[model samples]
Structure formats: C-alpha cells, structure tokens
Target: MRFTTRVLLLQLSTVVAVVLVSTAVFIVLAVEQLKQEAETSALSIARTVAAAPVVRSEVALETSRQINPSAGELATGPLQSYALDVTGRTNALFIVITDGEGIRMAHPDPGRLDRKVSTSFEEALRGEEVIAWERGTLGDSVRAKVPVFAPDSREPVGEVSVGFARAGVLDDLPGLLFGVGAAAALALLIGTGATLVLRHRWEELTLGIQPEELVTLVQNQAAVLDGVGDGVIALGTEGVIQVSNNAAEEMFGLQGLEGMSLQELGLPTDVIASLEAGEERDGIVVGDRVLYLDSRQVDRAGQRLGSVIVVRDRTDMMELSERLDSVRAMTSALRVQRHEFANRMHVAAGLVEAERGTEAAEFLRTMRDRGPVDYPLAGADLLTEPFLQSFLGAKSMEAAERGVQLQLRDESLVLGEVGGVEGTEDIATVLGNLVDNAVTAALAGPAPRLVEVTLLDDGPELVLVVADSGPGITPGTLGPMPAAGESGPDRIHGHGIGLALSRDLLRRRGGDLWVIDPGGGESGRGAVFGARLPGVMFPGDDLREDEE
Candidate 1:
C-alpha cells in the first residue's frame, strides 16, 4: 500500500482497538455494579421483612401459647392477620417459613406450604445463616435464610427463607451494554472513515503538483545547468540514465541517451573501469577530450545501492589551461625582449649624449611630447609587476579609447608580500573586472567620464575600490550582475564575460565582490564595485609596516 494508506490503517486500527478495549472494560465494571445494586436491594428487602411488626407479633403469640396452652388471647384475630400480612408485604421471588423439622409451614405460594423445598433446611435449623446462588424450581435465584424465634426463647422455632431471582438483577444491564457497545462501534467507524479520507486527500494533495510549476522549476534548473559551461548528469541508482543536460549530451555526442550505460555512452576505458570498480577517477582521457569523472556509490541509510557518475567536459578549460602554460612561456620571452630593448635604448642614449647640439635637442623635444603612461606601475614589486603592467595597460588603453580618464592612486604600493599564488591571482582578477566594469559604465556618460581606482592596506584585509562616474547601472543591476548570458532587460551582458566570470572565480577562491552604498545623485551616483581580500591573502609572516 501507499504510505498514506498504511498510516491510515495503523491509526484506524489503534483507534478501534482502544474503543473496543475501553468498551469491554466499561461493560465488565457496569455488570459488576449492577449485580452489587441488585444484591443490596435484596438485602434491604430481607432486613425489612425480618424487622416487621407482623413477624415479631406472630412470634410473640406462638411463644406465649407454648408457655400457656389455655391462653386464647394468643390465638386471637391479630395473630392470624399477622401471618397473612407478613407474607403479603415481603417482596421477593420466594418467601417461606419452615418448621424445625425441615418442612415448609407458611409460604407466599400456598401450594408450597407443608412441603419440602429444594434447600438444606437442616443447615438452617442449626442456627447458621444460609445463603447460596442456586436455581429455584422457577429459575436461577440468590437465596438467603433467617431464623425466626419466640419472644421469650433464644432457640429458633422456624426459619424464614427469601430468594431473589437473577432476572431482576440483570434487567437493565443488557440494554445498557448494547447501547454503549453500539455507540462505541459507531464512533470507531466514523473516526476510522474520517482518518482514511483525510489520508487519501493528503496523498492526492502531495501528488497533485501543478504542471506549470514543475515545468518552470525544470526550465530554471536547465538554464543553470547549461550556463555553468561544464557538463552535468544525474543517474538513477540502477546506473540507468535519469537526466543529461544539453552540455553533457553535447560533450559526449549523446543523442537521446535515456537508457545508456557509461560504457555504452563511449566513455573513457579508465572511467568505465573506475565506475565498474565503484571508485572515483578524474582528469582521465576520453577520445580527444580530457575530462574528469567523479563516481561515488549512491547509498541511503548506509546501504550500498548504486552509483552516480558526474562527467565534466574539460575540453575548453583544458585548452585555456594550455594557453596559460603558453603565457608562462611568453613571460620569459617578454623579459628577454625588454632587456634587448633596454640595451638598444641605452645605445641610442649614448649616441644622443655624444651628438651635435641641435639634433639631440630635437630628440629630447620629441620624447617630451610622447607623455607618460596614464596609469603607470612605478616602484611595484617583482611578483606583481607583470600582472599590474598587463592589466593596467589594457584598462588604460580601453579608457583612453572611450574618452574615460583612468586614475590610479597608490600605484607605488607594494603587493608582493600578499598571500599564496591563488590569492594574488584572485586579487588581480577582482581588480581587473571591477576597473573594466567601471570604465565601461563611465564611457556611457555624456561628458568627460572618470574611473577612480584605489588600493589600500587596511591592516587585516586588502581593499580595492573601483568607482565610476557614469550613467551608472539601472537600479535593478546594482549588485553583482547576473551570469554572463543570464541577464534580463535591466541587466545587459557587460564588458564581455569578464565581470561575471571574475566574480564566480573569486568566490570559489574564498573571496567576494559587492557594491558600496550609492548615497545620492542620479544613476544612484554611478556604481562602486568593491573587493575585500581576506587575511588568507597574506603570505606567512608578512605584515604591513608603516611607510618610510
């Protein structure tokens, strides 16, 4: 059964059990109470009969006659009426007077008189009070015996026996039990039915998800998956294909791969082997592509079930990585070229030093007109020299082209003592993207545009601020802009893919980018992109010293 049905069954069964058990307990206690009430009534009637004036007066007359046989007053009309009145007033199943010889004398039923009863009259004659649950000649009865005595003698002359039928004792019980039991059953049925119905509705409600919402959710997830520039796939525990986003599908040249295995999907042999062995392998070669496959056993509650294989296509990333390696190679070549150019300049300077006066003056005038770099990297450290030189040069050229002034403050501030390789690279990327965005935004302004670049050592963190004077962004794209291709109308893709990529890359490296408070003016006073590189950016044992 479904979960809801099972839960409903358990609940209903519990309720029914409780109701039935409670009803049974109540019935047992009620029956016992009824029996006690019945016994009490019977005892009350017997006591009333024993204490009656008629019974006592009759006994007195009989006793007086035994003392004086000629006492005619003892046999008067009062004594005769006493016997009839005593028998008539006693309300019981059977009331009889028995003589000491175990023979019935006076009885409510006249036919029972002068006859033996279905009781131990001998036991009653011994002055012992007799009571028993026994069947009378009519029906089941609870019988009791009491001895009658003369007024002058302690010895018993006759015994009075009273019997109460069981029918009257249980007269109201059966109806009460039936009524209570029926009500309990009805309540059980109603409660159980209600519980089941609610459970069914809950089941239907959960499964009744709206198609539009599901479609929207799936579409959004698809966009996220496709925008990552990486391949992603989801697999069922059985190793059958569950979902393969377009990136993954395109990477492996898979067409409608709904039921294909890893081996069947033309994966690398090492990857297939590792998957079969249920181990993770990355940076493996598949065909002409170098990819990473992360395989892990899919388990729930510690039970090994199956596995999920995440295939990441590293074709473009690997190419970029190769290009970076090439850039490292070019670093040395550029250094050699700088030295060679420097030697050539020294030679030209020496020649100028020895030249005739007018020719040398014209050369110096030409050099003066050339002007200095807009954002010069002077007195920078060796480690940061190349990056600053390349990045600032590129931005400065772009700024000049767009008629935007790029001002670099504190360019002499040394950054070589900063933390690990990754940290410095992240700082560079952060500053680069911010300045690029600032220049681009400022260029959109009507008049002279300006991008202010500031770098500071704030004791614990390195803060870089890139603020622009421009049309600024729309109020909507104030914060970190959307992913490169994920911008809506208010957020247009800006400055190629550098801004979004830089943000993601920096975030992955344990840093972040944010916007500062606008605080006034139109366009929200243009945008201020700020980056705070944490203490982790500083290398071991490096501390900021007060400048000389």
Candidate 2:
C-alpha cells in the first residue's frame, strides 16, 4: 500500500478497537443494572400482596385462640368482625387466607375458597417466609407466604399468601436491552464519524510534511539542480545514493546507477575515498571537464545525517580565463606597435622639417585628418575592446534623435570592457532595456526631454541609473505586475513586464533592480531606475565573469 493509505488504516483501526471496547463495557454494565431492577420490582410486589388486611386478620385470629384458649370464640362465629374490618380498608393488592389444614378460606377467586394449598403454603405453615422465582410452572409468579396467628397466642393456625405474575418485569428486558444496543450502535457510529473527521483534518495538516516530505523536497531540489547546468548528488545516512540530478547523471555517466553507492557510480578515486572517510571533498574532475565540486555533511538540529555534493561546471570559465590571458598578451604587443607608430610619425615630421615647410605642413594636415579618436579602451576582440564607450555613444545618439539627452556621470573610475568569464551581451541587454525605456518615456514629453544616465562603482557594487524627465509613471503602475490580459504589449499596461524580465536577468547574476530615490532627485517628478551588480571591477573584464 501507499504510505498515506497505511497511515490512514492504522489510525482507523485504533478508532474501531476503542469503540468496540467501549460498547462491550456499556453492555455489561447495562445488563447488570437491568437484573437489579427486575429483582427489586419482583420483591416489592410480593411485599405489597402479603401485607393485605384480609390476610392479616386470619393470622391474628389463629394467633389469639392459640394464645388464650378463648380465642376459639372469635374463630367459631361467621368471622363477621374480622371480615368487616378487612373489607372496609382501601389500597389492597391480593388478599388470600388458608385454614389450619392448608385449605383456602378467602381469596379473590370465589371458587378457590376450598382449594388445597400448594407447597408454598406448607412452607409458610412451618413459619418460613417464601418467595417464588420468576417464570415457574405456576404462571410466572412471585409468591410470598406468611403464617397466620390467633388473637391471644403466637402459635400459627392459618396461612396467608399472595402472588403476582413475573411477566411484566421479565417482558421489559428485551425492549430495554434493544434500546441500550441501539444507543451503543449510535454512539459507535457518531464516534466513528468524529474519528474520520479528526483523522482527515490531521492528514491535511501533515500531508507533504513528514520525513517523506523532506525526502520529496530534496527530490524537487535535485530537479532544480538538474534543470540548471550543474551536477548535484545527495547521500543518505548509510552513504547510499539518496538523490542524483540529471547533470550528475551525465557528469559521472551514471544515468542508470540510481540506488548505487558513490564509489560504484564512476566517481573519481579521490571523491570515493572522501565518502569512505566521511570527509568533505571539493574541486574534483570526473570526466573531461573541470568541475568545482563542494561536498559537506548534511546536518539538522546539530546532528549529522548524511552528505550533499554540488558540482558546478567551471570548464568554460577556466577557458575564458586562459583566453583573456592570451588577449592581454596580444594587447601588450599592440601597445608596442602603437608606440613604434608614434616614433615613426615623429621621425617623418623631423624629416619634413629638414626638407621644407610645405611638405611638413601637408603631412601634418593629412595626419590631423586621418588621426585616431582616442578611445578609452581598445583591443582586437569585441569583448576586450572598449565596448562601453561605443555603447554609450550609440545610446546617446538614439536619445538625441528622440529629443532626449543621455548623460553619463564620470564621477567614479570608468569600468573598461569586461570579457574574461562574464557575457557582456547579457549585461548589454539589461542596460539596453533600461536606456530604451528611459528614452521612450522622455520622448513622450515635450521637446528638450532629458534622460540622465549615471554609472558609478561603489564598494562591492556597480550602480547604474537611468532617470527620465517625462510625464512620470502613472500612480496606477508602481507595484508588482500581474500576468498579461487581453491588451497587447503596445498598450499602456501593468508594472514589471519589462522591469520583471530585467530584474530576473540581474537576479540570475546576483544583481538587482530597484527604484532609487523616486522623488529625491533634482527633478522631483522623474523616475530613477537603478541596477546594482555585485563584485564589479573597473580594470578587469568583470562582465565576462558571469557568462555561465
């Protein structure tokens, strides 16, 4: 079963077991209560019938004669006085009397007057009070018997007994038991429903949040690593292959080596030894390319669990560095050639001076017409050349055509063309977009529109600013932009369509875009867009450092 299913079943089983145990306990207690009630009701009915006045009088007359020999005087008559007192009273259940011989003298059934007594009467004659059990042959009755006494004596001469049917008490048990069973079943159902609801809520809270979630989170992280041009591998607590990205697969040629140890995945000997020794290893090459590998043990809550190894492809960067070194050599040779050319011009000027004034004047005029405009940076390669100056000249011309001025502040040392490892084209794209937007916004205003562009190198930051004097951005577009709607890109739209793309590019290179001092500048109404690229330098080809 799936892990989630197993969890749910385990929880549900516990609920079922508890409900069953509770139901069993309830039934046991209920049955005991019912038995006690039945016994009490049967005893109460017996007591009521045995205490009737008619039954009491017969016992009294028998006791009187047995005590005082003259008690026969009262027994010999029609028992008139005794019958009168017995019949006048109210609240009697069943009244019955039996003579000394165990024959009935008075009963609710007239025909039963002369009937012989049952064994219960004989037990009463022996002075023992008796109660019959429920559901016997005598019509499910509870019979209570008491010996009668004469008026003056304690000796018993007659017996009085009363009985009530036991069906009423016994019949109630089924319905009562059925009601208890139904209630228990209902409780169980409600408890089950409650358990399901609680369990479902718990499941939602814990979904994608277990140790398994951590595992899956690492898997997603590996996928991101694979998405990039980098290799990543993770090891579990036992040094097993926990995760491997596609780049790692290709880098180590282990595409089908999942679940294998790092030592078995064609890793370099040093890397494998590092894994065996449980020590971090870095900067190891596995294939034909240079790799910047960083390995460290994964830890949480101060406890070491496993290891993670990140391998970045640095081959291209190393090649760029080598190329830059070669170009620097070429630039040195070009500088020598330029120095020789200057010497040759001076010698020619001296020769012209020695020959005549007219030739020297002509030579100087030609030189002046054909002289090189001093560029701040120069090299054969496009990246090593002074591209910044060219870029600024081009943008300035475009802005001038649109009746706008693109000004660059020369406060900080100018950063020459950077080309060693970073891609200048990407940086140009970022700068070009900002400059274009500034020019466009500036042109939207009246003539004499101006866009102030500033570049500075603050410590650890390269700040570029493009502020435009136009109808300032609408207040409606100052926050995060939503996705596109039916309106096309040409129409006025939300923020960040251009800004977000520019920001994303900068972000990938560890740079950022922001609105700097919106209303703090000389023109309080214009917008100042700033891009900050980190670790930029003036003399080196820093732009090339971000190529990868």
Candidate 3:
C-alpha cells in the first residue's frame, strides 16, 4: 500500500480504538451511577418507613408481648397492612421487617411472615443504618436496613429492611448506551476527517512520492550536483537558497550557501537580477572574473520548484577570444600592407624598366619618407606595444569602411605594455567596447565623422577617453542596462550591453567608466566618455615619469 494510505489508516484505527474505549468506560460508569441512585432512593424509603410513629409503637408492643406475627393477620396486625401499603407505594423488591429477637413481623409473602429472616440485620439492631448490595431469600438487590425504635424511649426495637432489584436499577441502560455510542461515533467521524486532511497535506508536501521514491530522488540529486563541475544554485520561490553544490561554493567563494537570499549573497547587481529573472547572460564581472550564467525554473507535475542557476567561469575564454581577434585583425592589416607594397614595387620596377632612373629613385625616396603604410591613426608612433598597434589598426580600417575617421589623439602615450595577467583581460574588454562604440556613433553622424581615443598610463592605472563627432548622447539615455550574451565578434553592434558590461568590469577593480561630457547634439561639439582601469600597467614600467 501507499505510505500515505498506511499512515492514514493507522491514525484512523487509533481514533476508533480510543473512541470505543471511551464509550465503554462511559457506559459502565452510567450503569454504576444508576445503580447507586437506586440504592440511595431505596435507603431513603426504608428510613422513612422505619421512623413512622405507628410502626414504632406497634413494633414496641409486639416486642413487649413476644408474640409471633400471624399469617393473613389482616384483622390482628397493623404491621402486615402497613408493609403492604408501603410496598404498593414504593416499587422496592421487598420491605422485610424483623422483631427485636430476629423474627420477621411482615413480608411481601404473607406465608413467610412470622419466620426467621435470611439476611443479616445486626447493624440495624445496633442502631446503625446499613446500605449495600446483598443476596437474600428474595434475590440479589441493593438493600438498606434501619432499626425501628420505641415511641416512649430510646430502646432497642425490631429492624426494617428495603431493597431495589438489580435489574430495575439498570432499567435505563439501553438508552444511556445509545447516547454514548452516538457521541463516540461523532468523535470518530471528526477524527477520521482530520486524518484524511492530514494525509492530503503530507502527500502534497512529498509530491505523492513513496518513502523509497523520496530516497531515490535525493540520491539522484546528490549524484547530479556532485558530478557537475559548473556551479549550480537552487532557489525557492521565495528567493531563498535551497541548495548550493560544492562547485557553487567554490565559484562564489561562499560556504554554507543554503538558506541565504540574493541580498545576503552579495552578488553583482546584474548577476543577481539575471539569476532572479531565470535568464541567460554572459560576461558578468565578479571580482576580476568574467562569468557566464544560465538560469532555468524547475517544475514537476505542474508544481513550481523554484529556479536553478548554472554559472561558468569564462574569464580565460574571454581573454583568449580577445587575443584571437587581435591576431585576425593584425593579419588583415598585414595583408593590406602587402598588397600596397607590391603596387609600389610594380611602379618602381616599371619606371626602371623604362630607363627613368631618376623617377624610380624619387618614388623610392618618397616611399622611405612616408615611413609606414599603417598610420590610419594619428598617434600610432606612440604605441610601442604591438597588440595595441594591430588592434587600433583594425578598428581604424573598420571605421573607415563606414566613412568614419578613427584617430589616436596626439596627447595619448604609453611607455610600456598593458598590465600583466591580473588586469589584462579587463583592460582589453573595456577598451575594445569603448572604441567600437565611438566608431559606430561617429559613422552614424552628419559630416566630419571622426572618433578619437586617448590612452595614458598613469602609474599602475590606464586612464583612457573616447570622443565621437556624432549626434552625441542624451544624458537621459544612461541608466542600468540589462546584461546580455556576448559572442566572438566582441559585441560590436550592441552598444548598451557592451557599455554596461565595460563599466561593470572596470568597477570590479576599483576603477570606473563615466561620461566626461554628455555631448552636444545641436552644437558643434561631440560626446566624450572616460574610464580608469587599475592594475592594467606593469608596475614600475614607470613610463608616466617620462611624460612628466
């Protein structure tokens, strides 16, 4: 049988047993109470009869004469008529009266009169009243015995005894038992209903699973949570953490994660919201770690079991993706340079073949004077880092293709490469997004579409600014943007998501991105954005001192 069914049945049986026991106890007490009441009534009747002045005087006379009670003594004796009348009035089983010498003076059976009594009446003769259940010649009964006294003096006299039949004492037993049974049945019904309700509540809590099924479910959850490497967190509908695997503890650097809320976990705002919303998001910055997250709600049999979030540390992957983009861009730039070099070589060769030696030499001199074919940016010579040069070269080519001019501001200078492993990924991410945004905005503007980037190494911090000669930005457009997924192309077209993630990354390192100038859409000026990236410079590359 089902576990719930067995539990309910057991509870119901307990209720039935209790009710039956209670009902039986009540019925027994009821019979005893009735019997006691009958005894009390019979005792009162017997005492009243024994105290009568006629019986007292007559019994005293009979005692003085020492005469025997005659059978059918209706003409000679008041005792027999008196006993008969009293018996007729009260429904007692018998009203036996004994003389002082223990001889019966009156009895319900006249032929038995003037005979020795079968029941004991010694306490009554000694002036004590007695009430008890006893067996006599008539039958078993609850009887009362009392002493009859002389009218003139406090002297010993004959005794009077009264009794009620045992059957009569419990005459109302059937009705009393019926009432008790009815009450017990009602109680049992209520108890049964309560048990049913409790069973339903238990089933709901366990989702109607048996005990063994519950054990299996727990084992499966343990296996899955332990086997997975990605961080997994389970939250209840009320936003409390229900389960957090070991990977989650390690990933979030928090122990004892269960029973905590999102507020208590102290996760990044974007990450917390994404988890709460059960959405998929990537590139969330947490303590210098770029994280990707996917959250889904758990449901079973149409019941909501809250949500589960899977977290992956994507910091290394982001850095590698950036490196690949830089390589691809450098390769493209080199290819363009190779094609241009070949064209110049053809011109020089043709001139020499035509015997115009002076023209060929002049062309060669001009080519040398030009220094490099890769100066799409104004301050390209300032960047001694090969990665930065190639990256900027690629961005400039991209912007130019859309009719926008991209430039490295003349004041920008960097004496050493960007920071070491610590902040390298973060710096690259923020810088890439900012440059791409500036280029896109410049391309969309009216005329003189130009984008400028200024990078300065200040101590161990890289402070950079980007400005665009576009329609500019409205201050109101800035707000908390939602987090979104990022792909390999470096999130170029998604301005809002890119900007939000960039600001978040810098902020994680005690730096920030902000609007230096909200922009001038109607005026000739453009929008300027600035950022500070900490730990992005190799310590004591100390090149800021050179510019100073």
The C-alpha TM-scores of every prediction are 0.49, 0.43, 0.79
The sequence of per-residue lDDT tens digits that candidate 2 reaches over residues 1-548 is 55556666776677667767876786677666655565554445434433555455554654445333232343343443433334335222334566677655655544444566555567666766665553422455555566665445456667755554555434566776677668767876776677668666765655535657778887888568757777777787787877777887776656754588866754555557666565654434343344556777776656566787777765456444434543443354456447755875786679777987787777666545433222222221122234454555455655665667776654434444444335444446556667777777777655677777666655445667877776655443344222111111222222233554556556767888877644323454566678876654444456447543
Scored by TM-score, the top model is 3
> Between candidates 1 and 3, which one is better according to lDDT?
3
The lDDT for every candidate, in the order shown, is: 0.59, 0.56, 0.76
Which residue pairs show collisions in model 1?
A: 419-537, 419-538, 419-539
What lDDT tens digits, residue by residue, belong to model 3 across residues 1-548? 88888899899999999998898888888988998899789889888988888889878887888455466562247877888889889988988878788788888887787778898878888999899899888888999998999997777698999888888888899889888988998999899999999998998898888898999999999998999889888889998999989987776668899999866754556567778788897766444356678999999899998999888887667656654554566678777767887988998999999999999999998767553355577667766655566567767888888888888888998766765655655665777777777877776667888999998886677898999887666443443222222211122233254555566567778888777775655576677788998877763334556656
> How accurate locally is residue 84 in candidate 2, as Cα lDDT from 0 to 100?
32
The clash count for each model shown is: 3, 21, 1
Candidate 3 at 151: error in angstroms?
Answer: 2.7
Please state the error at residue 473 of candidate 2 in Å: 5.4
The root-mean-square deviation over C-alpha atoms between each candidate and the true structure, in angstroms, is: 15.1, 16.2, 5.3
Count of backbone collisions within predicted model 2:
21
True lDDT of residue 56, candidate 3: 91
